[model samples]
Target: MHGPLNPESPVAAKVFPSPNHGERKEGRRPDMVILHYTGMASESEALQWLCNPVSQVSAHYFVFEDGRVLQLVPEARRAWHAGRSWWNGEDDTNSASIGIEIANAGHPGGLPPFPDAQIESVIALTKDIATRWRVPAERVLAHSDVAPGRKVDPGEKFPWEVLHEAGVGHWVKPASIQDGRFFSRGDRGMPVEALQAMFAMYGYGIKISGVFDEDTEKVVAAFQRHFRPERIDGVADASTIITLRDLIAKRPAPTAS
Candidate 1:
């Protein structure tokens, strides 16, 4: 927490230390990588806010619009980015994952396309972190994946397929959107329970209740935002269900520790 900052990944050009980090709980080593968008008007403002102690939020690394990467918090430390998040049975996501904030004028700024250079840098940085830390492809997740109703960053515009092609994250071609038996808010039955079970099986933090409630809607939307992004209205259409099933079926096996 002192002295000259040392960049943990070679992808990072320099260190821009932020005071908004703490020790990882129980000395947990990062086994996941969480991607996010700054959702600000400018990259400078986003970077400044992250480094400012008052913001109380930070990521281990920050990527600029033109593809420049900066180390903010040491990889060994816990950055305060994943607030009130849960993933794959872990509530302390900050302690178990490395956070990367991409500088994009996210949803608020019309969900601008990420430059090819910037996305290439993201792929390189993610590959480095996943390789060095032994992070799994499925564990490389969007911010929306962890905090369902609360957060949505590195939004639908993010080229998850590109990252998968670059061997950074898990992905499967989304099933074609179509009409059929779908679940939505207010629906309830054994089918709903089955749907909930499938989502929970895939690491979404949702109760296995037999009713399609608000929380279920939110989780469905979150799943779509990450997987079947073509339509994200919180409705579980055949396309969404098929896509989720395919992802689960094709998920990479856990690597031996």
Candidate 2:
């Protein structure tokens, strides 16, 4: 509820402070950046919803379709976004990350394209935040990445590769989709356990129970949505697994504290 705030990053045009944030728990410093899409048809309404106290949701920044950037919450504070989300064993993502909500129609509006100007602005803003916070490349994540089944904003149509090309986030060429051995729901075995283990090792919240259950499927789909976005059927095909291995191999070294 702070009156007219100053923008923290040079990329933001102005401050549009929201009342929906709090101090980061345990005095946590952000090491991650979570991207989301405001899935409403009207950008103004979406922004208002985030600022409304009744909604209990807000992000650190808001990016409009024309690429205008607005700082809704201060970077040091914890925005109310990323509810019930987890990443790399951290359940309180709101405290551990900065959230950016991009204005887009998302799946509900047939997945509209993000304008080039918008994408460029997102790149600049993300790079600024990541640089200031020393956020790892892989830690620049989608809302769906951390909350899988519960959310899917900033959908596949969002150009992650574009951001990666600008040195903002992680990206590798996805493997070609082809027919091969695949694992699906209800499958069980050591291979399934191994698959789950790999996902968990890569920071997905999956259980290695030697069975491909519903949760595993959701995680797989989430992985596909972020990594191998060419197809997101929740089936772990050869392309999906190989792409994951490539990503793991190319993941940047952990940043020193």
Candidate 3:
């Protein structure tokens, strides 16, 4: 059971108490959800590490490869999973988000595809959390999204489209990949600045410096990984640009607007 063994999700069978959590920073209520992959060969090891105090990491939920769901931290408490992360202007994302780590042999294990059963579990769990927390469909994000330079978990093969089809998170038909105008590191100008602004407006921690620096490249790659998984070469190509524009266009309108 989680330290308090409180079950936050109706779909989760039980709490698996992880010691690696603390008070939500400044009494923050989660407004976002961050998904991650354990990146371990086995769920047992990953679970053990997450609860191990030395690991200093935990998530609100953990989904096994076989589809079993477990809560590792109380939903009302801050889980330590998102470390040194940012989204929009919020730096301590852990406090403002619920983290879920899916068990998988990650990119180091050759980027193994997430099992269909596991993905199903993720969709259900995410739907429950997002509904309960009133998290925006677009605010359901990848770990790499909040920590662009440091993380790539729940990588490109995580089947975001499948989740989208399940009515869990935001997604779109990725634009067709083709040769076209593109921006890569070292490119510069108003167009590049505009690209950075778009990414930043969409919550990626990119700077509108006008120079296509490494940070911008990583953020672009992160965007590609989550939004347009067809290609992730750190270049802002036409397909990527078009895809970003589409997502922005489709975002929900404000109540007054």
- lDDT of each structure? 0.94, 0.94, 0.89
Give the least accurate 10-residue stretch of model 1, judged by summed lDDT. 1-10
After superposing candidate 3 on the true structure, give the runs of residues whose Cα lies further than 4 Å from its correct spot.
1-6, 254-257
Q: lDDT value for candidate 2? A: 0.94
The residue ranges of model 1 lying beyond 4 angstroms of the native Cα positions read 1-4
Among all windows of ten consecutive residues in candidate 3, which has the lowest summed lDDT? 248-257
RMSD of each: 0.8, 1.0, 1.8
Instruction: List the lowest-lDDT window of 10 residues for candidate 2.
Output: 1-10
Per-candidate TM equals 0.98, 0.98, 0.96
- What is the per-residue lDDT of model 2 for residues 62-155, given as tens digits with 9 covering 90 to 100? 9999999999999999999999988899999999999999999999999999999999999999999999899999999999999998998789
Candidate 1 residue pairs in backbone clash: none
Residue 224, candidate 1: Cα error in Å is 0.6
lDDT of 2 at 17: 82
